[model samples]
Every structure is written in C-alpha cells, then in structure tokens.
Target: MVFDERLVMAFILENAIKYGGKARSKSVLGKILSVKPEYRNAIKDLIEYIKSKIEYVNSLSQDELLKLYEEYKDYVKTPTKAEKKSPLPPLPNAEIGKVVTRFAPNPDFVLHLGSLRPLIISYEYAKIYEGRFIVRFEDTDPRTKKPKLEYYKLILDDIRWLGIEPDEVYYQSDRLELYYNVARELIGRGYAYVCLCPSEEFSKLSKSGVACPHRGQSPSENMELFDKMLSGEFKEGEAVLRIKTDLSHPNPSVRDWPALRIIDTKRYPHPRVGVKYRVWPLYNFSCAIDDYYMGVTHVFRGVEHKVNEEKQRYIYKYLDWKEPTYIHHGRLAIPGGILSKSKILKGIREGLYKSVDDPKLATVPALRRRGFRPEALKNIILRVGISPSNAVIDFSLLASENRKIVDRLANRYFGVRNPFKVYFKRVSHIDLIKIRKHPDYPERGVRRFEFRDEYISLYIDFEDYSNIISRDPFRLIGIGNFILEEADKQVKIRYIDNDVKKAKKEGYKFIHWVPVDHSIKCIFIYPDTTYEGYSELNILDEKVDSVIQFERIGYFRIEDLGRNNINVVFAHD
Candidate 1:
C-alpha cells in the first residue's frame, strides 16, 4: 500500500511530542496498518520508513516540533463529541430567577462524601437558575453536637474548594433572639407549650398517646414558663418547649416533639456564644425558622431526613408560611471508606488517624490531601443527581474518573521505590540526556541530566531489577539499551547502542530510572502504606498540591516539601 507521508509524519510527530519528543516505531507502524491493512504484507519495510520519520521528529527542537504539529495535526484524527448533554437533570418547579437552594450543615464535623451530594446538587441548581444559594450552619445543639470554632471556617473552605460560593451565610447561634420571639409567638398562639415533665413520665405518656398534665396549661401560663426557662430558671432537661403535634401521631417521636430546650451554659458552653445564652433551639425549630427567614425556595437533603421534613412542616403550618420545595436524595455510601463522624472521631482519639484530614478517611479535606481533584468529585455528584435510591460509590470509580483528568495535565518524571543502584560501565565521555517534561505537551519544555563520568550510576526499582536480570538487553526508558553484566549487591550493566529501531526489533522491555546523583528524596504515601523513594530533581520545581505522574509509578500530589525530602500522596495509577 502507498501511504501518505504527511499523514504518517503527523502521527509520528504527535506521538513523539506526547511522549517526551520520542515516538515509538511500532506505534506508528500499527497506526498505518490499522488504517490500511494492505500495508500488513509490507510491515517490515513500513517500519523502517516509520523509524526514519521518528528519528527526524525526535531531532527537532520544541518550537520546530510545535510548528510542524500545527501543519499536520489535522491529519491526526481529532476527538469528536458523542453528544452534548447536561450532567444533572433540570429541577422540578425551578423557575429561572425565583429559585433558591440551601445546604445546611451542622458544623459538628467536617463534611464527608455523603454530605457532598446535597451540597453540590443545591449549589449547582442555584447556579442553573441564577438564584441564591445559602449556607446555613445549623449549630444550635451545643451540648450534644457542639459546633467547634474551627470547623465553621473549615466547612466554608471545603465548599469554596468545591467551587461554590454561598450567596448568604448564617449561623443559628447568632440569632437566638429571633428563635426566642418565634417560640413565644408559637406559645401565645397555643401551637406550642412549655413542658416541665420529667423525661421518664413524658416518654410513657407520649408513647401511650396520652397528654401529660403540663400539656393542658393555658397559653398565658405556658408563655410565662417559657420566659422563665429562657431566663435560666429551668435547668437542662427540666424544661423543654414542645411543638404541639397530634397526640395520636403514628410516629411517636413526632408527637409534641421538643422544639427548644434549656441547657446549662455553665457546663457545656457553646464555642460561639459561650455562656451568654441558657436556651437553645433543636434541629427542627432552628432549621424551620432560618429556611423561612433566608428565603430558601428549595431544600436538598438526604432521604434519611424524610421524617425530619415531615416534622419541620408543622412549624410552617403553624406560622402560616409557604413551604419550600423539598428534594431528598438517596444516601451515598463509599463501601470501604469511613464516612461516619463518630467512628472517625473515635479513631482520632485512639491515635489511629492523625486528624480529620487523615489520608485514610473520606472527608473532603482528606480527599483533597490525597490528590483527588475537586472537578472529579463534582462530576461524580452531578452524575448521581437527585436519585432517591440508595447509592454506593466504589472508590475505584472515583480513581478512574480522576485518572482521566490528571493524565494530560500531570507532567511525567521517574521515581524509584525499593531502589537498587545499577552502574553503567565502559562510558568513555560525558553525555547529556534531554527528556520531554510531558510527551503530549512539548511547550512545557524538557528535563535535562548531565552524566559527567565514565561510570554512570542510576537507581532502578528493585522489583524491576529482579524481573529483567535474566534478559540480555533491556531499554532504560529515554536513555538507551543496556546489557546486565553483574547481578549482586553492587549491580552493573554495559551500555549498548542508542538505536530506537534496533531496541524495538529486538523486543527490549523499557524501564524507568533516576540518576543517583541528580534526584531528590521522596516519601510516597498511600492510603495503607508508605514508601521512601527517589524522584527526578526537577520535581522541586513543582509547587505543593500540584499533581504529577511518576512515569512507571502512578500519579501523586505534592503534600509537603521538607528540608531534605518531598512528601507526596498517591492519587491513582
């Protein structure tokens, strides 16, 4: 078959530019044969021509490579879109400018993968309609689910990292007077009553669908009791203002559910308000009041809160307010990841985890530190959408998604773990090796290494050394082919010709190596294990939090750059 030289050169240049200015002869040959199977009969002759083209392409400078690529890139098949579709379905009853959404977190702990679903859905929906997105901190329960001062900022940072900026931010602790006035209005209207009954008696009476004696108090008397309770007369558990629901309600917890309860601020002082207030609101009351006041037109939460939705609606009914649109999605579970706040806290206390951002946990901070991209996470959430069915997210799915994003962006470098030093003997003079920083992006430039001695030393992974020890000649990646001469504590090899076609024809296995004198110390951390290794010295040019591929290793994000070593967390293969 007569091949188009221009098209073949385009393929060669594109491949070479993608892989550090060095294209493989076999890859170009395969591309030609695939498009024109008639060339298969003359594969031997085609490969020789392909090798000649590759040699010319590799010799070109970065600028020349790019200039030729522009002329011939059209010959290379450009990727075509399958279809244009939105990641999330349109929200029901979502008007263009009238829609509003909220993500109300308790601020008792950092957000996990489960909590991220509602947050992303709400924020994206608000963006879709050009409406307001509110971030309300439901932090009223200072005794049980106490809000820490640090977590408020941490949660906001997490949201910002996810590319969401709230139109309005609210903290329930700062609006105690508003909740007090609402509670007083409910009591005066006889929609709620202050109950001073003991817990055991209330439980027995409410369980049997019977009202306690205190439930029958007059509105005036109940109002006075509530005022006294707020003034610290009622100690914790001695007084709880209950929303008057049906006595025969099927869900017993919904019957006269406690709305506002007295807590002794002297014992469990709130991190925000300290001992300034004695009365605190419950989840249902604070959420209901804020949602109405903040003008939240829609509520996006998990299906587990269906019962809470039912309970909060009574407040809207009593106050004669419009109910917001409620969209409760399914629970999101990461099969092996620890998403439970209590368990994570326990692990932290027991020293099993370093902190909330421990690489092992599935918390947003942990995921960020472990090299997961925010865009990958946002895409995952959008694909799940508002499905009501319980969803389980396998971590492998996330890894797969992340790989696609980092592959083209992350620059490649050599890293060796369990390194076994190998010396190249019989080198007569100094040699300079130039490898492209990225095969696909030549503009990023190249990484150069200067070998200044007759005997050059490099570190190869011990595992790779064991695998290739029996082979007569193996390719040292961008360097050249080498024949193993001695396999002992001090391993050695003799250099062969740097002929690309010869290496390919002889079926040489390529392996990554780092110069022993020109590399930096690296601590490679994974979820379950950690390895000490050496990476190319140019890795120092990368900033912390930058993700880069370790050639034959995997992608990793720079976590910390120490005085002598750099720390990186493994993202994916």
Candidate 2:
C-alpha cells in the first residue's frame, strides 16, 4: 500500500501545530488508521516513517506551518460558511410589542448551560417582538432547596454578562401575602379546600379515584381553616390548601395537587424575608399566580415542565384568569457538565470544587472563568433557536464557537510547556530580536526581547528535542538554523545559516523558544487541571480577562495578573 507523502506530511504537521509544535507519533499514526483502517498491519512501519519525517517537519517556520495546517484542515473538515441570522420563531398568540417573557430561576445556584437555554431564548424572543423581559427569582421553597442570598446578584451578573437586562426583577419571597390572597380566593370560590388527611391515606384515595372527606367542606368553612392555618393555628404538614381537581383525571399527578402548605419558617426562614410567614406556596401555585399577575404573555421552558403547566392551568381556569402561552421545548442535554445544584453544593463542601467558577462545573461563572465568551454562548443558543427536538450539544462545539470569536482579537506570543533547555554554541551574537505580536496583524506591533549579554539562550519544548536529532538542520524559531554537534542531556549546536528561507528550502521546522532569563512565570489552567509553565515576559502586561494566544500553544485568557506571575485559562487552539 502507498500513501501520498505530501498529504501524510500535511496531516502530521497540522496535528503537530495543534499540539504546541510537538506532534506525537501516536496521534499521527491514529490519523492514518482512521483514514486507512486496512493499514492495521503497517502501523509499526507507518509510525517509524512518521517519526523519521517529524524532524524535517518540526523545523518549518511557525507561520509556514500554520498556513499549511489551515489549508489542509480546510480540505479535511470543509466547515460550513454561513451563519443563521433569522429572528426566533414567533411566540404563539403574542402581539407585537406586547409579548412578555420571564426567566424565573430558583436562585439556589448559578445558572447552568441548561438554564441558559430558556434564559437566552425567552430574552431573545422578547427582544425580537420588542416585548418586555422579566427576571424573577422563584425562591419560594425555603426548606429543601434553600436560596443563597449571594446568588441573587451573581445571577443578575450572569444575565447582564449575556447582554440582557431584565425589565423587572421580582422575588417570590416578597409575594407571600399575594399568594395567600390568591389561595383565599380559590377557597372562597369553592375551587380549593384545606386537606388534613394523612399523606398515606391521601395517596391511597387519589390513586383509587375517591374524593377526600374534606372535599365536601363549604367554601366558608374552608376559608376559615385556611385563615387558621395561616394564623399559626396549624403546625407544619398538619394541613395544606389543595386546589380541587377531578379525582378521576387520567393523569394521577394532576389529581388534587397541593397548592399552599404550612412550613415552619422558624426552622427554615426565607433568605430575604425571614420567619414572618409560616404558610408557603408550592411551585405550581406561586408560579401560576405570578405569571398571571405579572402579565407574562409567554412561558418558555423545557418540556419537563409541561406537567407543571397542566397543573397551573387548573388554577388559571378556576380564577377566570388566562394562562400564559406555554412553549415547551425539548430538553437540552450538555454532556460532561455538573448541572445539578445539589451535586455542586456537595462538591463544594467536600472541597472537590473551589467555587462556582471552578472550570469543571458548567456554571455561568465557571464558563466565564474558563474564557467562554458571552457572544459565543449566545450565538450557540441562538443557533439552536427554540427547536422542539431534544438537542444534545458537546462541550467541544462551544469551544469551537469560542475559537472563532477569539481568533481575530487574541494577540500571539510563544509559550513553552515542559521546557527543555537548548544551548546554541557558535551562534551569532545579537543585542535584541523583535517578534510579531500577531502574525496576521503586523499593525498590532511587536514584542521586543533584548539580550543584555552577548550569547543567545532559549528553552525549547522537551518533546521537540527529537526534531534536533532526526532533522540534520533545524531553525531555532526567531533565532537562526544550526547543525547538531553533540546531542545528549543538553543539545550542543553550531550555527550553520542565519537565513530562514535557506533552512526552509532544506525542509527545516522552526520550534518556538523563549530566552532563559527573559521569560516570566505562567500558570496555564485547563478545563480539568493546571499546568505551570513559562511564557513571553510581555504577557504580564495583559490585563486580567484579556484573551491572547500563546503562539504555538493555543488561545488562553488572562484570568489573573500579578507583577511576578500571571494565571491564564486555556480557551482553545
């Protein structure tokens, strides 16, 4: 079997550039196997051949390699060129400039990628129709899923980071009285009754399609019981205000669901309004009341909540109030993300996570800390565009979108991870060398490095040292090409030529290098872990949160800045 040597070389060089100018043998061999699976027997020979050619390939100039990689990558991937720009599907029964949407978060934790779907879609639809968008905190349950006081502002910050400003913000904690009045109205209208049956008996009766004995109580009698329950005459779980529904309804869950329940506020007080009220409204009740009272025209949410919408409709019909236009899109599953608030809180307590900004989690702060752009996130959400089909997105797709946005703006510099010192002997003595801040944008200016001493010294990537042995002549990146005299613990080289084109003619690869004394400490943080390394000194000048490319390494965002050391989060290659 024969292969096009040029195509093979292109694949090797492209993968090498992707991995900080040091292409691994396994990676190159795997590419071959993927394309030519029948070449299973030739794996050993193919790896040897690839290793043999890497020396020459490794010597190619950074600019020349990237150009080749880009060309070859385009041929292999053939990426789509057009972007979706149409407005979101129009909300049903929504009048122009009159549609209102709300993002009601529980406020127990920061918003996850799943949560962002509704937040972005609702806000976008509201904008598309020039309607009002509201951000409501549904922190009604002060017991099981307690609200974090700090998350209130953090969630707003996350929303603002996505370039959205809610027209109004409301907390359900403040609307306890409003919910009480609504529950009273339901009782007065003979549509609700206070049930004191044991939970086990109630479950049995509900399943048997039998009405509770309390269901026959008069409206006035039920109203007094509800008032007594609210007035602290009832202990927690002793009585609950149940919205009366047909017991024979096909859906058993919709059969007489509980509305307002007595909660011991003294044990678990609301974060914002503590211990003042003992009666608390459940999700269906509080959410329904707020949606109707706040005039929400559209309720955009995941299909998982379709049942909740069904239950809420009962309340709406009984009160003669119109339910919001409920748009239930299919679930959005983001693989490899910690979306559960309980799990995240547990992880935080166990010290498995540092904070909400921990890169391992998919919290808004984590994405932001990991250098994910708001525009990229918003664009991905927009492209998905309220599709009813269950949408499963890979985290890599988000990274790909982010790379596109940051590529144009990120300035370039050299970063050597796992550094191996290479001392060039018989080299030309130069005072200073200037490297382009960005290869494509010369107008961005240059990062100047001055050698106070006479001789040039640099640290090259440890993996690229094999190139020095396999390729007879190689270029020292911004420096010059040299011939190896002695290759051992430390490389001994003699200057052969200073002309890069001359070396390029010989198929030499240029490796990224940094002066031993001129580099600064850099901590490169990955999604899963951290790597301590060195980068160009000028990177210290980058402000925190500014994105930059570490030349052959990849794009990274400056997460923290200090006079002596800087921390960067890896964005993408």
What is the alpha-carbon lDDT for the whole of candidate 2?
A: 0.82
Q: Could you give me the TM-score of model 1 versus the true structure? A: 0.84
The candidate maximizing TM-score is 1
Best by lDDT: 1
lDDT by residue for model 2 over 149-179, one digit each (tens)? 9999899999999999999999999999899
Query: Which runs in model 1 stand beyond 4 Å of their true positions?
Result: 1-85, 426-430
Per-candidate TM-scores read 0.84, 0.82
Q: Candidate 1 has which clashing residue pairs, if any?
A: 17-439, 18-439, 18-440, 19-439, 20-439
- How much lDDT does each candidate structure score? 0.86, 0.82
Residue pairs with clashing backbones, model 2: 58-509, 59-508, 59-509, 59-510, 60-508, 60-509, 60-510
Local lDDT at 242 for model 1: 95
Task: Score residue 564 of candidate 2 by CA lDDT.
Answer: 79
Least well predicted 10-residue stretch by lDDT in candidate 1: 78-87
